[model samples]
Target: MKKLTSIIVLSMAVAATETVNAQTVQKRYEENPFTLVYDGAITRNEKGKVNIHPITYQLNGITIAANIYTPANYEVSKKYPAVVVAHPNGGVKEQTAGLYAQKLAEAGYITIAADAAYQGASSGEPRHTDKPANRVEDIHGMADFIAQYKGVDANRLGVLGICGGGGYTLKAAQSDKRFKAVATLSMFNSGEVRRNGFQNSQLDTVQERLKQASDARSQEAAGGKIRYAGVASITDEEIARTPTDLYREGFVYYYRTYAHPNSSFLYPMSSLLDLMTWDATTNIDLINQPLLMMAGSKADTKYMTDEAFNKAKNAKNKELFLIEGATHIQTYWKPEYVSQAVNKLVSFYQNNL
Candidate 1:
């Protein structure tokens, strides 16, 4: 009888332990990981006497949600200079784009940081679709939105795009004279990166990738679940395998520390397949606006920035500023780097606008 009781007690303890472990697993796994925004930043819910509002704008028959951060002491009748902020490839407006918008707005400018179509709080069909033309149109759409706002001076408008957004911004300014001044920090020419290669040399890998994405479309149309392959969550082992450490740094910012409740490390996985065909640098000859393209000296994308700067012709005012010690993602949210970017931008706009 004593042996029987002991056995039963041991079994109960083992079951209880298993139950606790299962509960922990369920709690983490059940909470969807891709639904976060701002990572942990308070940009979306952040308050300012400048009247931050959640607004929606129509683009290509779809509505995109945007956070408009206005000037704190703005006057309704007075027209203020405005700057349109664009987000990174997979990021929403709440990430670095929102941060820059908030900072610029605090600097007494009306800043509209919008989520690209088919992603984040924005509404669109076949979500996570990436067409260079559509993305560029999204930027132009935001410009149109700001141009019609209560206190925005359309003539004094400027543009600031970070990373992939930077590339799209450049393309927008190429033809849209509406942008009096333009700037791109860590600009990524997606076409070059997608076709030629990362640093503009490798080719076979990109070709293979193109074939894979092209093949997947057929499988997708057959009532099949699309399997997206790209960087979502980056583990430490993934970081070590990279040729440069900057990519690892980028992963830390986008996937881990700044992971928003609505920002997904993997939500835009389908966008990668479309990215293979999108190019934001084809029409570089049309940027007549005062252009300021700044990049970190140590960034992996510095080479691409150089290529773009060389291509942008006929711009009367253009300058390329390289910060001494910064990486591609560093300028996104870091105070020291952000301030540097904003200062140059403010100076350029003030003189040009």
Candidate 2:
């Protein structure tokens, strides 16, 4: 019995050492010299002649971290149009969302990008909870907070959601008329993909997957270990063998060139319970504001944008613009595509807001 106890103690010490090494070796902005790490990032802030204000506020009892970008020569007393930019799943406010906010602010608008609760520097228990309802509420919270910001013209507010956030923006805009214009870039329908599988590839295993999710939930309720799903890590050979450009390129974007420590495409396994029951296209026609949907012409996930755009039947003015010769992930960072999308967004918000 004494020998058995000693063996267990030694095993636990080894396990703890491994966990510490994993934490220490994770990626950071310092690894990439070109990484724009903070809000109102120093180098670009000067180049763009804009300012980024890092702020925090309470949302539903949780502290939310965000960045608000003000246009050059901003004046608190003067009325200015504002936009709320929502980040993609597994993405933080400081990444592509911040890039767009900075660009839009340079175009003479006040913009904000925020981390979702339970993710990316935000405070919440059971970290990485990716529920649809919580994401929608985050958008509303942004609107509520920004509408009251000094110099903002609440009457002329707009919204731009990227990837999964795009789907939630559609749902939020349906009832949140405070958003005068709504737009999406590379829109990905989380619920549709979760329920039926990406590109409808998991139709046969729906019940099997649901059972797994149910079992995970039961485990958590009984005080067992929390189970997570999605890509925690990937190898070069696996990415090379990936069948779709969307995921293959996405792996490069998230895990290599633009990697960040907090950015991960994971969610609790039990999240599938709510995710499988939700669809981003349902009631999409309820969006009464002007809508603009943009997707890369070659994006494998373009079908999601196409479906949602077609269903936004009641939008006051709707336009579908395609960026030629770019894939879904490329739109997030490639220079030409980013410029093209930003130019279109500027014009849309100018005309509508």
For lDDT, the strongest prediction is 2
TM-score per model over all chains: 0.83, 0.89
Model 1: per-residue lDDT, tens digit, 1-353? 99999978877876675566445534432352322233232323324355566789788898988888787767779889999998887778767887788778878899998888877778875666666777898999999999999989898998998888899999888888898889898998876776677776667677676676667676777867775655655554465576764567766666554555345434333454666666666778877778899999878888888888988886667899997788888878677888898888888878988
| Cα RMSD for candidates in order | 7.3, 7.1
Worst 10 residues of 2 by lDDT: 31-40
State the C-alpha lDDT per candidate. Answer: 0.76, 0.88
State each candidate's clash count.
14, 0
Give per-residue CA lDDT, model 2, range 199-235, as digits (tens). Answer: 9999999999899999999999999998998999876
Off by over 4 Å in 2: 1-28, 31-48
**C-alpha lDDT of candidate 2 relative to the true structure:** 0.88
